[model samples]
Target chain A: MLFKNLFHHFGRYVIMLGSAFSKPERASMYYKETMRQMNDIGIGSLFIVCLIAIFIGAVTAVQFSYQLDGTLVPVYYIGYVVRDMTIIELAPTFTCLVLAGKVGSNIAAEIGGMRQKEHIDAMEIMGVNTAAYLIMPKVIAALIVIPMLVAVGAFISIIGGYLASVPTGVMADADYIKGLRSFFDPFNVTMMFIKALVFSFILTTVPAYQGYHVRGGSIELGQASTNAVVFSDILILVADYLLAVVLTS
Target chain B: MIRTEDIFKSFDETEVLKGITTEFYKGKTNLIIGRSGAGKTVLLKLLVGLLEPTSGKVWYDDTDFFALDRKQMRNIRMEVGMLFQASALFDSMTVEENIRFPLDMFSTLTLKEKRQQVDKCLERVNLEGANANFPSEISGGMQKRVGIARAIVLDPKYLFCDEPNSGLDPKTSIVIDELIRDITIEKNITTIINTHDMNSVMEIGDNIVLLYQGKLAWRGTNEDVLESDNATLQDFIFASPFLQRLRDAALKRG
Candidate 1:
């Protein structure tokens, strides 16, 4: 029964995505909506992304310095460790996890509210493709903006590591910069962008699907919003593990 | 004109509409009246292609609505307009923006032309100068007028209103009913309204279809409603003792 239900939902999700990616009625209207979503997703999320990235970098630097005490490992390796961690793992994974909570639930609630209000049905009767109109712009905006946000997050995290280690006499500023510049592979940056793109697709579409198919009243809408976040977070983590295995191996 | 042939809708094991065949004429106020669970909403949704009937057909003039491909269906839908019970005005937009949405999406009218069209619709709905107000800032009656304004903005050939008078006072309901009636006549558009308001029935029901227990139990005009001997129709129309007393007094006066 559980497997059947899972397959049913998976099938529905795929069909919903097919409709959402279909051709739009008016390109200009869609363009306007896309620009609005870009502003919301990009500008609205900058502060939270920066805050989380800085803390992740600082904590990692402090913990690594503690582990390196009275050991053969160089303290300057703190910079190396924080740089790689923030790029390969922290920036894409943690930032997306936070967004899955903030943006994912919000998309679900917004679309679900429209459903309850009959706004979607009204659009449909107007000869508008409601799925494409509502979901495509959001997906496009996230795809374009989320990678840039992740890039900014990674840059801020490196600066945070330097501040935590070098300013407090834990390491010299020159040594910390050297460690940051050392042994950096360009492939890691490529991997970071790849994860960002994939996570962006998952977070936006999963919540939109939840919102689009929502039925019943406020309680059902609330449940759909919660499920959107939960499912998006779970899928993002699973994708993170899979991407790590594939990209590293 | 819109016609349905043997329309049947079922959800899982329960059937909501059982072979409902009917016609709504062009340039007429057609009302679908029933109690809360009588499948009026399901039938309306099916007619608009929101839900496909399990076994049935809907026709807009000579076009078989369900037989058309996606693009063809959309072409037909472009000529359709709907007003929802809650008014369904996009809350994020001003009244003029809401009314102009269809024009923005489908028409190549210049911005000035669109604004003129919006003004004309607002005037038609007796809501002139409400162009800058948001739906939330308006009264319920004003919001319903906005919904009507938006519905007719595209010059749709067919209009559907799902409970246009649901929450209005009696006087306001009569005004809305009369407004819809006038629009139907002026545009020669096929208009279908789903409502249970008795005042709406007597005032604007040029044609009426009443469903009971998922089947068509009665069909007539506002004139027949008071005189019909159909037991089910009587039980429904005179369900309240106050209405029954009024009916008895009218009969005695006659």
Candidate 2:
């Protein structure tokens, strides 16, 4: 029974996405909607993303500094560890997991409310190809903007490490700067972007599926929103693991 | 005109509509009236392609709606407009913006032309100069009017209104009914209204279909209602003792 239910949902989700990728009845309307979504997702969440990144970087640096205090590893290695840890793992994963809760729930609620209010029906009867008009713009915007946010997050996290260690006397400024500039592999940055893009697709589309197929009243809508966040978080972790193994191998 | 052929809809083993076949005519206000669970809304949804019939066919003029490809289906939809019960205007958009959304999505009109069309629609719905107000900021009657404006904005050939007067005052209900009827005649469009409001029935019901227990029980115009001998129709139309007595008196006089 569970497998049947899963297959049903999976099939419906794939079909919904298939319909969402069709040709737009009008190009300019889609472009305008995409721009609006970009502004909302990118600029709207920038501050919170930056704030969380700084805290993550600081904690990682502080804990690593403690761990390395009596070890063979040099103090400058704290900078390298923070930098690599951030770009390779923390930036894309942490940022997207947070976004899965913040933006994912909002998307689910917005679309689900539209469903209940019959806006989707109205659009459909207008020949608008509602799946394309509603879902495509949001997906496109997330694909474009999420990677940029992750890049910004990675940069901010490194600064956070500096602020936590250097000015606080945990480490010397020269050693930290040397650590940051030392042993930088550009491939790690490429890996970060690939993770960002994959995670972006998951976070946006999962919530959209939940919202688009939502049935019943407000309570059902709330459950869909909650499910969007929970499912998105779980899938992001799974995807992170899979991408790590696949990309590394 | 639209025609249904042996339409049936089932939801998880519960048959909501059973072999319902009917015809709604052009340039007339066609009403589908029934009790709450008699499948009025379901039938309307089936007609508009929002819900597919379990095993039946719907015809739009000479075309079979279900047999069409995606592009052809969209071509049919382009000529259709629907007014939902709650009006379904986008909350974030102003009244004018809501009406202009369809135009913006499908029409090739320039910005000025689109604005002009929006204004014309708003004027027709008697909502001129109320362009910037959000749906939440307006009364329910005005919201319904705005919904009507949006529906007619594209000059659709087929308009579907579901319970267009559910929560309005008698005066507003009559106004809405007249507006819908006037638009139907003016545009020579096929207008299907799913409603149980007796005032709407007597006022503008050029064609009426009554469903009882998923089966179409009766169909006639407002003129036929006074003299019809169908017990189901008579029972539905004159549920109250007062109305029944009134109908009896009218029949005796006739």
Q: Model 2, residue A95: what's the lDDT?
A: 98
**DockQ for each of the predicted structures, in order?**
0.85, 0.88
Q: Model 1, which residues run further than 4 Å from truth?
A: none
**Relative to the true structure, how large is the alpha-carbon lDDT of every model?**
0.94, 0.94
Span of 10 residues, lowest total lDDT, candidate 2 chain B = B242-251
User: In angstroms, how far off is B230's CA in candidate 2?
Assistant: 1.0
**Candidate 2 stretches greater than 4 Å from native:** B248-254
Candidate 1 has what TM-score?
A: 0.99
Q: What is the RMSD of candidate 2?
A: 1.2
- Chain B TM for prediction 2: 0.97
Computed on C-alpha atoms, the DockQ of candidate 1 is 0.85
Cα displacement (angstroms), candidate 1, residue A69, comes to 1.5
